[model samples]
Target: MKYLEGIAEFCAVADVGNFTGAANKLDTSVAQISRKVASLEKQLGVKLLQRTTRSVSLTEAGTQYFQQVLPALKVLEDAQLAVSALQASPQGLIKLTAPVAFGEAFIAPLLNTFMQKYSGISVQCTFSNEKLDIVEQGLDLAIRIGKLEDSTLVAKKLATRHLFVCGSRDYFKEQGQPRSIEELKEHSLLVGSQPYWRLFIDNKIQSIPVQGRVRYNSGNALCSAAVAGLGIAQLPGFYVRKALASGQLIELFPEYKDKQEAIWAVFPSNRNVAPKIRLLVDFLAQHLVSDS
Candidate 1:
């Protein structure tokens, strides 16, 4: 336990790149932090840091040591927090980000209920279509839609989203329904974000170039245009489910629908995830369902 004291302090110093910053973060005196690190280096029989007045850097050995030990320290810290959480109620400000339409439609309501249930917690949410780096932005969590790229962050599956090729009933009556993917070239198309429509073809993913008289960045706007009999639009299930049910729009090809994508709650990978983040991820997993 005595040896462990400086391990966290050393990591803090490595993270902030300075003793004063680490000391401030740990709420300890610079002298105490310095002593702890010095003691640790003596015990290890190696110099861990090269310190200067302006900044500090790890030695090559120190870098290797930090890489090896950081994960273990994180595990220990998480264990300690897990024990504490069992005795304490969840309480903290959770900062999260999500896409605009989905956030407004679903996440915001879910958070409202979550806050109501956990009176000690508060939430800060950012709604944007643009993807932002959660770690650099200082966000606790983020809701990601569609395919997730290979990343270091942890992702918890929340729901599934299906893409639908649809057109208004009136448009289909006049322009004729496309019986196959090839026929789409003859009809007026409505597109958003991407220039090509993605669909499952021959048991594989296929991208077909799409051109349209109208284009929109917002899914809602694209759905609205399709509903107004402008053209066929490929949109997410959430954006067009109601219209499909109401007879305002008709699903194009059931057999050639795009592959379903997952909605995920993503956060920085850590051994001891905060209770606020854990609870929220669990809550969404339990409640949120696929729109399709």
Candidate 2:
């Protein structure tokens, strides 16, 4: 049992080919995953991975070890799932928070289904854009987007969100389409809390400082402004998807969309995660549409 400690971590890195992906899959921190895998290599006295800034590759010995262990791990995982499926019905009070728009558009509908499935389970939610300390608030979960402030939190990735730059056809016609990033200076930009917009231009990520006519903390409000032909806005796909599809808004510089951000369900690692909470996260991950 002592020697078996890092096998799962090593296996995860091998399958995902990156520590961050393994961390997401295992619902742990990347540092923890890296430590475990490094410990495993030290124990075996073999260099199993060739790690680079951008990629991870297997050594010849690692390939052989992986080929042998992957099937065994699969069997172990299958057995665990088979056993867990027969456990008691998960029921408890679950408290959580998410971005208002996302919670309203996606999480709320799934929650009704979750409550129906677990008759004894009760739910409470707080929808806000401001970040809250879940552990300090004595909350069970926090559904978050983009960078996580606390690196130690245990997080399971739920979905990917795309930020789209768009404006109404009338707005484009009046202002004239921006042929380049520099041309954006010629028109008004609608923005949120940040004055800088994160975008991919010329195949490189850039954070360009912007001066906008209107600034709102709400993505929904910014999206509406874009639809009203007030200005060009950068909004998440969930906020602008329908508008783009309906031709109410046209995607600007489609080839230069902002990088996708992962939507995560995060919890305090110090607390013992109850079955009810685990099941809820699993349900969300399974039901939420995945990009890959």
Candidate 3:
């Protein structure tokens, strides 16, 4: 017996509540539908339907199996649709939203390359610090940084944005480097949205709270301040990689460094996910992972 055919029959009968009604819906004979259901039950070694002359109903076991199999069948159908969409030409506008800084630094460049490769696909990318509802705003994809709090969106890891605690050479000379997380208190710190910064020390992760003379919402601004010898700032790797390499800013407390902060591509869970969105997500993962 064909597994999918059996599943189709089982679902049909479960939905229409009788072999005759199911047959009508499936555009097949009642005898054919009944045979399919019988074959399915034989294959699974489980009684899936209880029938009488006047009425048809599921057994206790059948009800429980139907509850599980129905959703599983739907997912299998969706997977088939997704594969079919992949074979079709990816011609669509992918509405995407991303963080203001990361979009500018990383995603924008990749989009340039991606667009060049897939000429048929066009992307309308928006950069904002404000989080928008992807479904509500009709967005196809979103690039998210850091650990996520919301479980509604399906997220795929793209890359890691490691945070670095650093200050310029001149500032480090004058104010001195932090020997430990505790020593950060002695210096003027440049901070961002969160009061606490993530750090890893000797195989342990810790969140250290630090006060700063100045705080900026923009990570770019905080990095600029640290470069100008304002104060030490805890910033992401992408923002400070060049400066750190140039010795404009020196990494502080090397003993307590997290490998890299996580970055993810998020999309709303729905039926018939667009090929354009799927293409972009997979492209991003490959592009970023290859570069890393």
Candidate 4:
């Protein structure tokens, strides 16, 4: 219990690598933060932080202690949030990120409606494929698709999506349908930013290389070209559903579509999930369709 005195300051310094940053985070003077941390080390009889002139880092024991305390702190925060959920007003600026194409097509519209519903809240959105550091970048939330990488961030599945290899009926008739993965090379396979396509074959996932007359980084453009009978292109269900339904595009290898991918809303695990943040996530989860 004695070591718990500076737990918040210690964690903040670990996160930002400086006492000045930790003081700024907790709204205290650097001297007070430093004194508290020194007293904590004395009580625990361990050097938790390895301090340098320019930066601070956690010792091995400090790392272990931090991991244990962080979750306990989060649980305490959750209890507080649950009690205040109804009392708090949703009034704040939320900064978030999402995939470029999906954000433009789906998330942007929902955000517009959310802002209208909560007149006091505003939004700042960044659309990019690069995995930006949410904690370092100070982002409140991030919307990610497909397989998520291993990280310390907390994620909530918002929806599901599917991928398919598709082409126009005219192109299929002229080039012939590909019966197997190897047969893909014999036809015009429109390439995307990735030179290879992932397909489910024989109950296993396989990355098969594909080549074609057209290459586009944008899924919308690929879908349009496939609809215009240019060549075959693999795209997500949301992009080709209308085309497939209208008979403009035919789904090739119907049985081999990749397993349903999850769309996620992620945020830094260390921060408390504020009322406004939770509200936006709940809104998105309620609105985003889970259908493939």
**Number of clashing pairs per prediction, in order:** 0, 0, 0, 0
Q: Where does model 1 exceed 4 Å of error?
A: 1-65, 68-76
What digit string (tens of lDDT, one per residue) describes model 1 on residues 1-292? 6767689888878866788767755557889989989999998999999988887999998999899899898888778778758866788788889999989998999999999999989998999998876654657789999778848788998988788999988998898998888899999999799998889888987889999889999999999999999999999898999999999999988788865678999876642478778899999888897864
**Model 3: clashing residue pairs?**
none
lDDT minimum window of 10 residues, candidate 1: 267-276
lDDT of each: 0.85, 0.83, 0.80, 0.84
lDDT value for candidate 4?
0.84
What lDDT, from 0 to 1, does candidate 1 have? 0.85
Candidate achieving the largest lDDT: 1
Tens digits of lDDT, candidate 4, 217-262: 9999999999887888988888888999999998888788787678
Q: In candidate 2, where is summed lDDT lowest over 10 consecutive residues?
A: 77-86
Work out candidate 3's RMSD over C-alphas. 11.0
**Candidate 2: clashing pairs of residues:** none
Q: Estimate TM-scores for all models.
A: 0.78, 0.69, 0.69, 0.75
Those runs of model 2 whose alpha carbons end farther than 4 Å from true positions after fitting are 1-87, 202-204, 290-292
1-292, model 2: which lDDT tens digit per residue?
8788789889878866788767755667889999998998999999999999899999998999999987887787667656655767765588899889889989999999999999988998899987876654557789998878798789989888778888999998998989888898999999788888778776777888988779998888998899899999888888888999999999887777766678999987744566778889999999887431
The regions of model 4 sitting more than 4 angstroms off are 1-13, 17-88
Report the C-alpha lDDT of model 3 over 1-292, residue by residue, as the tens digit: 3666678778768866777767754556889988988988898889988989987899888899888888887787788767768665667577789999878878899999999988888888899988876654557678888778779778888877567889999997887777777788889988899898889966878788878789999988998999999999988887888899998999887667776667888876543466677788888888774212
